[model samples]
Target: MSKRYGGKFSPEEGRPPQTPSERGSFRGARRTRAGGRVNLLFFAPLPLAARAFGSGPTELALNLTALGALLLAAWLTREGILAQEAYEARKIARRPAIPRKMFASLLTGLGLGVAGLATSGVSAAPLIYAVLGTALHGFAFGLDPLKDKGMEGVDSFQSDRVARVVDQAEGYLKAMTDAIKRAGDRQAEARLERLQSTVRDMLRTVEDDPRDLTAARKYLGVYLMGARDATIKFADLHARAPNPQARDKYLALLADLEQNFTAKTRALMADSTTDLDIEIEVLRDRLEREGVHLETRDLA
Candidate 1:
């Protein structure tokens, strides 16, 4: 018999089978309460286009400017909402340097005022519309985070370093994700995601204690960069030839990496716990030296 090289047809050929957990995981991934308001703001200015066309050249220019300002305000509002969410997600996060949402509200008022002026030149109507627009915009999208979070006693310099390193590590994760997609293997992508999740756990641990940034610098910087390069090479090779053995090896590497990251995070947490215990013990000893009596319940 002549040698033949062929495999059975698969409906899911070149695609990984979806797992139960993967279903609905992405349904609300990008959906946010603020997102709806952002959408509404974007659409609210659409009427200005028609109004601009019907008006005189001066009025048309004013309406168009108002439309442009409103669109910019909408963009800024969306960005501010996203920034606030990111800030809330982190255990230690700095407030946004610029208050984008507050500025957005101001821009909204300016836009409304300009539009009103275009419709009725220099009248009380413009002032009322401006005030109402500003108030409504402020209500719909809250102000940006105004204060630094979890940085009360922490060194600003060390926190900045942690932020920089974490940002770079995230870039590595993003690069890995992008590279793996070229391989056209959803299984590989899923594996990468699992590994990335473990990596993020370590990142959160480091962020919680800026001191850990020094210890984890090698893992976050050097090791992650190496992993990213390896992933790019593996993705290229896998795209050319889908080798099961190579896939298995890559997954094994991911398993090893995840194990190390989890261990490191646990170690950092342990160190923090130890420090806290020592501080508590020292405080108790100081109280005892001061001749303070403590009941067993109070000590406990």
Candidate 2:
């Protein structure tokens, strides 16, 4: 099994793993506003499921159908909420292709309406329930983002390329995470998460300046693929026979990768800063040529 990380830059270098409060790993994490009510949605369909059994032929069918629809609606609603959260988290994102929440609302209404029919057969009550349920669902979960964000002044082609590459990179990180869990070593799992965090920092940097995509492609692609493959191999071998040498070697590989990724992210940010400085200088020159004279202090 892997020992606790004791790399040169690790804060836990001679210490044990710290709790989240001690390390502040989740210091700035945003509290999610999704899925709380969605949990209730799952439970709400239980009565219909209970009623599904021990009923006559017609009532049994209606109850079963209602239960299915309501459960499906709950699932769709949860997914829609998660999608919205992802959209909000990114600096650049496309609108979801499907309006899942709207469909969920309709399903919810249909389920409720069917339930009303099962209980109170052929009446305006069912229709009323359908309308009210749909309305309430709509009001509760709200709508999906209807337009792309952070695309203003950005080339569609470039943004799309970056998005695709980032998606692939994220997939690689996820695989590393999944593989690390198989080793069943908590410290190794924690180290993998920290490494993933470093990679994501690079991702965010590239997203901020799509021009960095060219330079970061290899880091996000080739290097990450190699890391993922190594992680899988290590996990498999470690699962079969635990070895200190192998585990330490894998940890060293993680440390090296983390350092390289961090350096690359810094270089990319430096390049962006240089570009901004150049732009400012050119604008000042243009203003001066236009006979808009200003003292150094005034410019400052």
Candidate 3:
């Protein structure tokens, strides 16, 4: 019998293990707010499926149409919640490209109205139900953020560049995430998520100061692409033959990449602080020249 290598590493060989607190810090830290009601929406329309199999063709048609519309509304609502969460997470973000939640509300009302019309036949109940359904859906999900945020005084051209680069980097991260899932190792998935978090820190830094995008371009583009490719290869190899050596190498690579990304983010922050200090000093000098004796007591 051949021995199959598992991806687990011995504590003596690998990097020092993370403390329980450190590991648990992120366990419940990140979750979307679109779960409970959104999931319920999926089941709520199941009864329509059975109704679609009615004896009358008109009844079947109406039920099938309502079912499709309701499912679409559920999908739109879930996507809108996710988009809103992403928007909120960023210090600077454009409004969502589509107002999915609002559209979902409209779709919900349309679905309900159609169902009511089919059952009640030209009654005021259908109109009342439509209005109530739209209102309730909107109330539950809320409206999409309608305006760009934290974009004042920032060059639109520079911001656009940063957005484009960040979007590309996100695609790379998504690929890595999808590929790693194929490996079926929970630890590896967790490790990849940690590395992704580090990368996102750098992304957020760049987004806050578009000027940093030029300096950090290589890290965001070339380095991240390489990491993504390596992840893809590792996932494939690990799935076929789970080699401990390969797993260790991959883990080490992730550690190095995380460290580099973290260091770069710190450097960018330091640069911003330096710029602020320079502006303050220039302002102080100008004030002194103008005979405005600003108190320096707080300089202690």
Candidate 4:
């Protein structure tokens, strides 16, 4: 997946510093700064006018126009920015940012502005535009707490947990698959390596936390199913070789390896370590169907 702030995905390599929660926090701060900027944009000309010209009717009118422009800009910017930032951040941080309701104020502000513009009479056009601008100002600023107040704590905890477990699983699988590639059958080996890395990522998502456990596990289960299918396909290809004797030997070796693979996976699944148990169960089931038993090992 293409990460916005981070580079390409590498299962074993350390991620580009910022975690999902960190990204969220950064986004929140950016929003706050943006709100401040919007406020400044609205009032910017007033200071220039005040410093350059003493209070006067012309200056007052110009300041009002500038203020209205700022409000309109702020309102329009919030929705687009929120949507864009959320989309980019999703690639790296998969969680659904619970308390998604916090953005309601922004929607409310944007709605009021649109409604005011739509219903205003010709004579009231300027008044309606000014009201819309105010609404935009409110929307841009009203969601500050949702972005800041205790949000980072909740998001950070889950982000770090997911990252740590994901890093470990990916590292382990990468090492194992890299070793297998040196034994010949590079194509099959490459497929296995890729499958394992994919599985590692899915597992990390499922293993992240219990909040969005249902969705995470569903996707993770699919990845495991794919992995199992890949292994089975490899076995099938080995069965149709030119030499019957060589094919039989290859088939026997694969069977032994698959059996061992099952046991090893079962061991990993059996561990009661992570907060997401439902995902662990789903992963175990998918592997078991393919005759690969996963054992969960407890660390503490």
Q: Rank by TM-score, highest first.
A: 2, 3, 1, 4
Model 3, position 5: C-alpha lDDT score = 60
All candidates: CA RMSD (Å) = 8.8, 6.4, 7.5, 20.5
Candidate 4, residues 160-267, lDDT tens digits: the string is 545444444444554545444444565445435444433443453344333443444333344444444444444455544434554445445444544444444444
Pairs clashing within candidate 3: none
Local accuracy of candidate 2 as per-residue lDDT tens digits, 1-300: 987656878775667675432332244467776657789999998998778787888999999998999999899888888888877877777778888999999999999999999999999999999999999999999988898766567888888888788778888988998899999988878777777877888888988999999999999999999999999999999999999999999989987998898889999999999998788778789899999977766544
Cα lDDT over the full model 4: 0.44
Q: Which regions of candidate 4 are displaced past 4 Å? A: 1-154, 197-201, 207-300
lDDT of each: 0.84, 0.86, 0.85, 0.44
Worst 10 residues of 4 by lDDT: 20-29
Candidate 3, run of 10 with poorest lDDT: 19-28
> To one decimal, what is the Cα RMSD in angstroms of model 1 from the true structure?
8.8
What is candidate 1's CA lDDT for residue 92? 71
Residue pairs in candidate 2 whose N, alpha carbon or C atoms collide under 3 angstroms: none
Q: Count the backbone clashes (under 3 Å) in each candidate.
A: 0, 0, 0, 13
Best first by lDDT, ranked: 2, 3, 1, 4
